[model samples]
Target: MASSRRRPPVEAPIAALRDALARIDANGPVLVAFSGGLDSTVLLHAAADVLGAGEAGSEVESRRSLLAIHVDHGLQAPSADWARHCVGQSDTLGVDCRVVRLEGAPQRGESVESWAREARYAAFAGIAEEVGAAALLTAHHADDQIETFLLRLVRGAGLDGLVSIEPDTMRGGLRVLRPFLGLPRSALERWARSRGLAWIEDPSNRDERLLRNAVRRQLVPVLDRVLPALRQRLPQTLAALREERDRLRELDRRRLETVTEPSRSAPGRAAALSLCAWRRLPAASRAGVLRQWLALHGARMPSRARLAEMLRQLDAPAADGLEIRHDGFVLRRYRGQAMLLPAAERSCEGAASGFCLPLRWVGERRVEVPELAGVLTIERIGQVERVEPVGPVKPVGSPGRPGLAERWLQAPDLELRARSGGERLRMHPGGPHRSLKKLYQERGVPSWARRALPVLWAHGRPVWAAGIGCDADCIVSKGVRYALDWQPLRRSRPASAPERSQH
Candidate 1:
């Protein structure tokens, strides 16, 4: 059992809240993540004091308004009670409050702590978006930061992990502020007691089975007694680590931009890395670049051994369809380019290849092909001045693929489907038909991506391919024309998953 005595209260917590709120770039509604714990109770109180009672239209006078989001993960039986307590506390303070109850528990083989944290933040993000919040405040204090550092250190974390908690940072597009990072937990407890505030003690905090609980209970105290100055020194050390981390991150971003490009398969949703350019980087820089690239696609950081293995594989021959799976994503190397794709995309392509999507060419602007995970856009390019059957179509604009003649495109029987074997396109009138396999090989399209590239068919013959130009037979020397372009949906990623903390 832990002692219940509280230290003398100080004015530091309120000052810290004011400073933190002032630093945010935007001015709008702010949300306090209230957990009904001593740290959060103090944070909520301080927030209400600084930002006012958060009535409707309060933002008109005060730059920002306040509200409380109490996420009930429901991991314990008393979670509902804790939520009620948070609402009661918020109401007493005259702050608007909402209780979000999280559904489901940790899946098999998943960490309860990780699941809880991810689900909790996900819920917060949803509410913040709904309320148009500029920032979300958490009650992470100096002690929590110290605990984080020690946990990461003992777990063999790298510099990114060792940076511990950041005072201001973006998570899942939400600005998360930790005003209490500079204040000790004891200060919060003292403030709560001084004001006679009430809070809940999470029963799971006593469960040493959780690594964080064990560290806080066993290791933090031992370190505190052994080195009385550790708390002060550790924060300085962490701040320096964070500075170095930011510096390296900037350097890595510059280097990454040179080697990477928008994914030709799923632009905006995924990225493509040029293997040749990436290989030219120094060994140390390569790891950083790879880590950053994986992050853009929502992949958690790979272990040192795992990252090393990925590098080793990249050094090998550029094998089309080479895949390395990690955290619900598949990193694939195809056609001298490395791509990060959602695991589902890789697994389901085989089945999707055999299905034919039949549709009419009714002058529609876009056709959504869910099975192919992309959209087929047919844009009218106006009248074709002249068709050079012996040569490729003249460039009308960017993405200048040859246009399909509107007269020929109006045929009743037209379908869009994945590539089947032996498909060929006649590049020019009276020219020898070329196999799609050979054409894809010439264009450097990877075998894996070929299955999903939607092919437009008319009168039982392929008229146009998504990434490739249309058949010359489908073009007219005169009259209206429509260009074919396929845009694949952004590679899907898990919307809510533990990030930065666990894989």
Candidate 2:
């Protein structure tokens, strides 16, 4: 009879992980995302062995702190027990453990899988921040990469999507390190069994309804039987794809540099480019530039169909001022230039119409208007005793009167509102009144943004419009001039104000 003995420990997986970690060279502390699964268990064990727990006579040189973080998604019945199991296992290994309990369920129309992943990563980011760890490790192995590539291929993803699962990348200000990407799942299982490590088996993993499980159970087995060399070939294919992607990205970067213009109103946001300049590129290069620009602004790349539609719209005669909405942002073309703005800023879209907020601008220097999403500043200019009319001295309300400063101070409390319709402004004192619509059209303001642009009204009369400047009726004498500054708030809390544009 054959001997009933256990197989010897496999050191290849552990060795590979050590080499990957060394190459990563994390300068600060490390946090492992311990899910109490076989792959993660092996990862946690290898990490603890390589990064000692500051004990004496350890083989590891660095004494950096090591911690395990388990996120309880609370989707499974045994999830709580799994968390406890992870904590216990980490304790047994002399590593600190943290269990983050997620609150709330996935919203309507949200995929449970995507929600779980987003929540899990959010928890990891928070823990990494709390612990001041520089690196966050996960146990995504070769199998996961293969499954992802296969899934993306089936979904008809582009080159970047095919190579999405990177070995190391930055996420939420922490270095997200996947050290086991080169190691296979079988290697991890062997290592775990050799060390007598305990782990939980998620029953949901066996459900073929999930695409990953379906691939793992049905497709991978068939692929293994039919083409045994596929596993080796897939990685090589991905490496070549990555090289090609890098070349295309470098070319796109150079092209973007030539056509990009700094946003005059929003700093650190997506830059603007002339439609003429964008159209000058080859069709393929145009798509690449668009992808790179969206990536720079942290926006998701649009689908190929949507991208083609955008390109088609760019060619239309009316497309010069059209707004194309997609993926939480609005792509607008204004004055032959294309730029992106947040979708929420589309105050005129659907049921959420533009709002009007009252502002009592007496002697205050600054006023914050949430509805318009920006601040207004009134800086008092130095007083002048008497002033002579300069060349082409624009008239205020009266021909012999002062400029904007004196008139603005005499105005009553202002009503801040976005454009509704039928608004008009005087281009000059005693000039013919023109519709705000016509004025905006002539000035090349995108139609979508006109609704969100701030318009200050005193009592019932329009006094100032952002980007258009103070009303000619409200212009004060040359003496004591005050500049009315309108600063638009950024998507994030900006470090500095964006550059202002004066009409």
List, residue by residue over 1-503, the lDDT tens digit for candidate 1: 98899955538987798788877778679999999888998899888877766334332325477889998887789888898898888888788889988899888977878788878888888888888889899999998998898888889999888888888877766788899999888888888898788889988789898888898989889988999899888888977887788789779989999999766544335669988888889987988988888877667777789899888888787566578898777878766778877666666688776879778777789887777777777888877677555565332235544578886577777888788788898876888889888877766667777787777788888988767778888876677778777765654323342233210
In Å, residue 18's CA in model 1 sits off its true spot by 1.0
Q: For each candidate in the order shown, give its overall lDDT on alpha carbons.
A: 0.78, 0.72
lDDT of 2 by residue, 210-236 (tens): 889999999998988999988888888
User: In terms of TM-score, how similar is model 2 to the real structure?
Assistant: 0.74
Candidate 2, superposed: residue stretches over 4 Å from native: 1-10, 23-27, 54-58, 94-96, 101-110, 126-132, 172-174, 262-269, 348-369, 375-443, 455-465, 468-503
Q: List the residue pairs that clash in candidate 2.
A: 402-476, 402-477, 402-478, 403-475, 403-476, 403-477, 404-476, 407-476
How many backbone clashes can be found in candidate 1? 0
- lDDT for residue 273 in candidate 2, whole number 0-100: 72
Clashes of each: 0, 8
Name the top lDDT candidate.
1
For candidate 2, the 10 contiguous residues with the lowest summed lDDT are 494-503
